[model samples]
Target: MKFISVTTADGLKIIINLTKKIWPVAYGKILTMAQLDYMIDKFYNETALLELIDKGHVFYLAQDDNNNYVGFVSYELNSEPNKTKIHKIYVLPETQGTGLGRQFFELVKEKAIENHQKAIFLNVNKYNNAIHFYTKLGFTKVKDEVIDIGNGYVMDDYVMEVDILQ
Candidate 1:
């Protein structure tokens, strides 16, 4: 698989398309349909994503050997002074167990080290099962948070972290 840096409108569009395919499956179980759709529109729109990039979010698209864009991840260096923040990450449901997810994390890990960050972190929904995938990657729950994302919804998540400088 190849990781492509997303730096243009075309690339952002690709990430938006992938989110439409991956979000429903990734969040369906723990989130109501209304909440799911709301969150998608709120965060995945081209305007919002571009704003994130302007604020230092770096996005990468993972393309398979056959040239399919199977997944994507975005991170921010120095989000916590000496740590990087994973803003988003998702792989197609069929690609879940094929090591693509770990590859995404490793992609972030390598960049974090190069940026002199000591660790990387992300927020995962508390009821989401991907917490297990994260646990297996050495991330420990650092804290829990309830973020009000408007529209009568709140994200109850665990702030998970893994050291990268070790």
Candidate 2:
């Protein structure tokens, strides 16, 4: 597998396309259709993604040996020094158990450490099965949060963190 840093218009478009393919299947049971649509529009839109990139968010496209995009991860440094926040990580449903997620996460950790980040954190839906995956990857729940993202939807999540400095 390979991780490509997304920095161009084509790269952004690839991620957008990958998101459209990954989200519905990944979040289908975890979120209502309304919430899924709203979140997709709010986060995966071209403008939103470009804005995030402009703000220093780094996106990586994960591809297989055949060069097929299989997953993606996005993260950024936080206001607090030595901390990195994982903004997004998703793998296609078909690729879930093939270690793609773990590979992507390892890449994130490598990048974080390279940037001098001591810890990495992310928000996971309370009911999402990925919490178990994160736990297995050395992340522990730090706090619970309920974020109102408008449109009558709220993200009930657990903030998870892993101290990479260990």
Candidate 3:
């Protein structure tokens, strides 16, 4: 698969739609539909995505040889010293066990290195097995926090970092 940058407004909507589909499938069992819907509306709205895109955040579409979008991710400069933050990463549930996520991270890591970032960091849901995947990619847990997502809902996440300069 190849990664393409999101360049059109419609492209961002497609990404968000895919994200909405994947979110419930991925987290519905772990979270209530009410919670999931709330978070989706609160975070994935067009305005929010447009803001990120405008700020030059990197958003990638993982496309097949035929150019079908199979997955996507978003990231941006981290406020921490010499680090880049992976804001979101998702692969379609139907496409998940195919090593696409690994390839996706490899591409992101290469980009980080090219930008001279010493490390990369990401936040994963506390209940998700993605920690195993991230660990396999050399990410080590650095901290854990509950981030408020408006209302009374919050996301419990494990913050992990991989040192590319090591």
Candidate 4:
């Protein structure tokens, strides 16, 4: 697998497509249809993605040997010193058990280390199955948060963190 830095408009568009493909499957059981629709529009819209990139978020697209886009992750330096916050990570449903998620996470860790980050953190919906996956990858739940993301939608998530130096 290869990780491509998403810096161009075309690359951002590809991430958008990947989001559309992955989000429904990943969140369908855990979130209501209305919530899914709202969150997708709020977070995955092209304009929003461009704004995030402009705000210094780095995105990487994961491609397989056949050049198929299997997953993607985005992260940025957080307000906390020496820490990075993963804003997003998603893999194709079919690729979920094939170790692609781990590969993607390793890439994220490499990027964080390159940026001199001492720790990496992410938020996972409390009811999402990915929580177990993150735990298996050595992330520990630090705190629970219920973020009011507008439109009557709230994200009930666990703030998971992992010390990269370990």
Candidate 5:
């Protein structure tokens, strides 16, 4: 697999398209379809994604050997004073168990260390199965949060973190 830095109009479009494909499968059971559509429009729109970039988020798209996009991740360095925040990470459902997600995470780990960050953190839906995956990557739950993303949707999530070893 290959990773591409997402900074152009086309790159943002790929992220949007991938999110559309990944979200239903990833969140279908956990959230109502209305909530799912709302969240996607709220966060995955070009304007919202651009704002995240303006705020220092870095986005990466993972591509397979055949040059198809399989996943994407975005993180911000020093998001909390020596910590990196993983703002978004998602892979195509077909690629879920193929280590693509882990590779995306490892890339963040690498970048955080290079930036002298001590730890990386992300928010996962409390009921999302990915919590187990994060645990496998050495993250432990640090706190719980409920974020109101508007339109009567609230992201009830657990904040998880893993310290980077020097």
Candidate 6:
């Protein structure tokens, strides 16, 4: 797989829609439809995504030899010192168990370290099975909390952090 930085608004749209596809596949069994819909509309909207890109966040779309986009990951350095947060990571259903997610995550780790980030953090829905995936990739659960995402909805997440510099 070849991973490339997204350079156009059209590319961003492809990433957002891919995000939608993976969200349902990864989160639907854990979250209610209403909750999932709220997240998709709030975060995957073009304007919202553009704002993220404008804020110095990095977005990557992974493609195969045929140029078929199969996965994506996005991350940003926040105000917190020495830390980078991975906002989203997803691989298509057909590629989930094929090591693509691991490759994408390693790319995220490289990007974080290149920026001098010592650690990386992300929140995973408690009911999702991806915790094992993260754990296998060296993330340790630091805390569990309910994040209220407004509109009477809340996400019960396990906040996991990985020490990339280690």
Give every collision pair in model 4.
Answer: none
For model 5 the TM-score comes to 0.98
For each candidate, what TM-score against the reference? Answer: 0.97, 0.95, 0.94, 0.95, 0.98, 0.93
The list of candidate 5 runs beyond 4 A from truth reads none
Point out where model 1 deviates above 4 Å: none
Per-residue C-alpha lDDT of model 2 across residues 1-166, encoded as one tens digit per residue: 8889997778888888888898888789899988998998898878888999999999999989988998889999863588899899989888889998888888888888888889999999999999999999999999999999998899999999999974
Better by lDDT, candidate 5 or 1: 5
Tens-place lDDT per residue, model 5, 1-166, is 9999998778999999999999999999999999999999988989989989998999999999999999999999999999999999999999899999899999999999999999999999999999999999999999999998887789999999999998
lDDT value for model 1: 0.93
Q: Predictions ranked by lDDT, top down? A: 5, 1, 2, 4, 6, 3
lDDT of 4 by residue, 1-166 (tens): 8889988889988888888899889999999989998998888877888899999899999999999998899888863788888899899988889998888788879878888889989999999999899999999999999999999889999999999984
Error of 1 at 100 (Å): 0.7
Candidate 1 on 11-129: residue-level lDDT in tens?
99999999999989988888999999999889888899899989999999999999999999999999989999998989999989999999999989988888789999999999988
The candidate with the higher lDDT, 1 or 4, is 1
Q: In model 4, state the lDDT of residue 86.
A: 88
Q: Tell me the alpha-carbon RMSD of every candidate.
A: 0.8, 1.2, 1.3, 1.3, 0.6, 1.4
Worst 10 contiguous positions by lDDT, candidate 6: 73-82
Per-residue lDDT of candidate 3, residues 1-166 (tens digit): 8788886788788898888889988997788889999989877888888888788678889888887788898888654777888888999998998999988888878888888889989989999988999999899999998998877888999999999964
> Cα lDDT of model 3 overall?
0.86
RMSD of 5: 0.6
Judged by lDDT against the true structure, how good is candidate 2? 0.89
Which portions of model 3 show Cα errors greater than 4 Å? none
